[model samples]
Target: MTFENTKEFAQQLDSQDKLNKYRDEFIFPKVNGEKVIYFTGNSLGLQPKRTKAYVDEVMDDWANLAVEGHFYAEKPWWDYHERFAKPLSKIVGALPSEVTVMNTLTVNLHLLMVSFYRPTKSRYKIICEEKAFPSDQYMFQSQVHFHGYKTEDAIVEIKRREGEHNIRLEDVLAKIAEVGDELALVLIGGVNYYTGQVFDMKTITAAGHDAGAIVGWDLAHAAGNIKLELHDWNADFAAWCSYKYMNSGPGNASGCFVHEKHHNNPDLPRFAGWWGHNKERRFKMEPTFDPVQGADGWQISNLPILSLAPYLASVEMFEEIGMDALIEKRDRITAYLEFILQEIDKEVDSTFEIITPADPSERGCQLSVLLHGEGRSLFDYLMENGVITDWREPNVIRLAPVPLYCSFEDMYDFGQILKAGILR
Candidate 1:
């Protein structure tokens, strides 16, 4: 399909768009009394308009039922988290029994590591992508330290080639082989936060297992943005935050996956709590920690229902639209965004190089643009002009044209605003 940098062309596309009407479901912030062209869904998703009803139900339940809400409320706070299992399983490509919602992303990762990241005297090294999200970096460092190993000796980072923007899959596989018997774990972000490259998890997980190591993914950017099959891929575990493409809220609850193979393994280690105990026997208050069979076994405490409410609202939206429809719109809109960028680059004196992979299968909604002859001033200009985008250090601007809310006209209008900013 051809794209044109014109309002009429954009509007024509919008008219034909099946998902365009869903944009009204979200509440967008205004700049200068007009709705801003939001490109930060990769950071914080716009709140769904229906979110209020979900939260209000919980708040009202608490007000009316008090302690009884745990047993008698509409959602039954005691079993509220059970609601996420089915819908979230579909989103992340896992069985309902293999998935659960718990604490936050990093916290869940840490808890999961207790079960998956076991290292022995000979096999102690962990392989991860270089420059992982800062939180993961800190977690890795701390985890190895707690196990009495230096980060330098225990963590092996897969580095991108000198001029390349993304890590090569071959390189990752080769690194896994090189680490070989010493490799205890292979964990990396499924979609890199910096370059927006989607890793091949199935192949990587298989490769890690062949090397006698456990494999997992941090799906912070991939969970709702791209296709995933944690179960089919045989990933030992995975976790992701709900605040990004999932659109839960700021620092909201997280979703997790634990393969079914590990469900019956009583020897698998994890931090236990009353919530993770078997549901029927939980009220018995037995001293033994007989954990719930699947992913719920990792839960450390009772869920925060208020946090899960917004998440439940969002996942239900995903269930309604389905991932197939979302991906169809995501690819087309992202391609159109890239086309707009290239068209504007041709007209302007500045050069805009897209650092993300050109293949649709290798990227999601984000396009990280590496600017030449441009800097933070351009980013500031865009924000002031009602274009809500993200600015990385040095000279890169990240734009995520989220399919649920952003429109085609936003790409055309952003081109106009961007051109003016460059000229100014």
Candidate 2:
């Protein structure tokens, strides 16, 4: 599709967009009584208009039903998190029994590590990308430390080749093999946080398996942004927060996926809680811990109804449109954003290069642009001018054209704002 750097063209595109009507479902922030062109869904999603009603439903159940709400509320609070199984499994491309909504992302990561990252004395090394999200870095460090190993020796970080913005798949696969017998696990971000590079998870999973290693992913950015097939990929485990593309709310409950192969394995180590106990025998309060059948076995505590409510509210919309449709719109809208940025760079004398991959399959909705000279002011200029793109350290500004909320007209407005920013 040919894109024009004009509001008329953008408006025309928006007019034809199949997902355009869904934008009304969100409540956007305003600047000086005007709605800003929000492009930060990769950081925190906009509040769904229906979120309040969903939360209120839970509140109302609590208000009248009290303790009885656990079993008797319209949507029982006892199995509140269970509601996410079907929608989330569909979203992540896993079987319903393989998925469960639970604690925050990092906590789930640690829990999954407890079960999947079994580093024996002979093979205790873990391979991951350099500059992973700080939470993941910390988790890896602590987990290594807990096992009486040093981070420098036990954690193998794969850096981007010198002068390159993203790690090559070949380099990643080679590193997995190079680690060889010492490699115990391969954990990586599904979509890299800083560069928005979507890794080939299926191939990576295969490589890790061939090298005699378990594999997992921190899907914080990839979960709702890109298409994923966790089950087909045969990933050992994965975790993701709902706050970003999932648009559940700030610091919302996260979801986890575990392959069915691990479900019945009583020998697998995990931190247990009552919620993970078998429902039939949970009320018996027996001394022996009877674990649930599948991914539900990994839960460490009762579900947070309030937090999960917003997720339900957001995912219901996902259920309506479906991920295939969302991805179709995602690729086109992101391409439009990339095109606008490239056009702006051509017209401007200053240096502006996209750090994200050029191939549509290699990225999601995000485009990370590196601004060479006089860039900090330009980032500030965008923020002050009612454009809501996010800035990373050094000189990169991240803009995500979210399919469910952002429109093509907003992309045009962003290009115009960026041009003015460079000049001013």
Candidate 3:
């Protein structure tokens, strides 16, 4: 908790990091055969070394017994996905019955929207932060249009002042107040992808509920990045992809949450599949659409074991280190990075601003850097030097040294590389 300069800070912080051992579990990205400092878990997480073995277990099951693999595999590919529920539930702070791993992010979003985004005459509007992930924007538009409403009229996008990065909590509540009776659904990212701001979900959900609106969160960046208490927050529903912070590999399956109170909604119209049918009667195919309780009821397709396995492995790591230690490490490393970036800006004549919140509690691991005139060149230079960060459009570079794998030495080295690049 105490330190000198960045190097001393990093060294002392690393020494104190309870989750430091988790860094060895992953296969960091290699560029030209060198392990690059991967500060882009906001974009994609490093692959856990156990991923192959996990995949092989499923593979062996399929090879040894085709249909029998369903119930007889090593982990039993049939209920294999369910094995992840307990751990995943802990990661996102939901009950096992309220979480399910299935489908891609946008698809799951649409499915959850089907259940949660009920729009009636006087109460037919959706509230979200402006410039939400393009996928969410598209899904909202298509969902509204499908229901015979123009998206522009039905959607309200909350934005920041000129040149600002995050949407303020007060602004969010004020907008909900303005929308009042008309706001039927409030869907926003728990952590904004670009700014790395972790929205106050408890407050947001409370305000939405007070306004008589259903609240949902897109935890694409928040899940596994920060500690969440979705159930306690009384959030109506939420969904997240597993590839980035969850380390589930690219295009991995997504997870969803529907509160236990809404899980038995016999009246909620949903785009259902047989997979969403009552688990006991699923194979019977007796035809009644009895949905499983909680978030599992929102599932629409069979579990993809291959993709889900990587997530399972990562969640296993999460269970070992726990979210508390993970978040502590994350905040320290991110602060180090932010300090170094600011230091670099001080030494230079150019303008580079950190758009992410200065408070660690307000963010996850990510820091969004807004560069001025030389942003692009600085980005290219860093990339060419094997400093792996992500560039969001219009002059913002996003960096996230995930606590599970990124090293303090890694952050220090990244700072050095970044400084050298920007100074030149």
The true-versus-predicted C-alpha distance at residue 87 of model 2, in Å, is 0.8
Candidate ranking (TM-score, best to worst): 1, 2, 3
161 Cα displacement, candidate 1 (Å): 0.3
Residue-pair clashes, model 3: 1
Worst 10 residues of 1 by lDDT: 344-353
TM-score per prediction, in order, is 0.99, 0.99, 0.96
In candidate 3, what are the lDDT values of residues 1-424, reduced to their tens digit? 4433467667777787777777777887677788898888888888889888988887887888988988887787767778878988899999988888888888888988887888898899999998899998999999999988998899999999787778999999999999999999999999999888999999999999999999999999999989899999999888899899988898888888888888766898898887778888899986678887767767767778878788888888788777888887788878877777776677776478888999777998888888887657888998888888888788989989888888787777787887788767
Model 2: per-residue Cα lDDT over 1-424, one tens digit each: 7889898999999999899999999999998688999989999999999999999998999999999999999999888777788889999999999999999999999999999999999899999999899999999999999999999999999999999999999999999989999999999999998999999999999999999999999999999889999999999999999999989999999999999989999899999998899988887888878899999989878788999899999888899999999999999999999889889888887478899999999999899999888557888899888998899989998888899999999998888988998987
**Highest-lDDT candidate:** 1
Cα lDDT, all candidates? 0.95, 0.92, 0.85
In the range 309-402, model 1's lDDT, one tens digit per residue, is: 9999999999999999999999999999999999999999547899999999899999999998899999999999999999998999999999
Rank by lDDT (best first): 1, 2, 3
Which candidate model has the greater lDDT, 1 or 2? 1
* Cα deviation of 316, candidate 2, in Å: 1.0
- After superposing all C-alphas onto the true structure, candidate 1 shows an RMSD in angstroms of 0.7
State candidate 2's TM-score: 0.99
Model 3 gets an lDDT of: 0.85
Clashes of each: 0, 0, 1
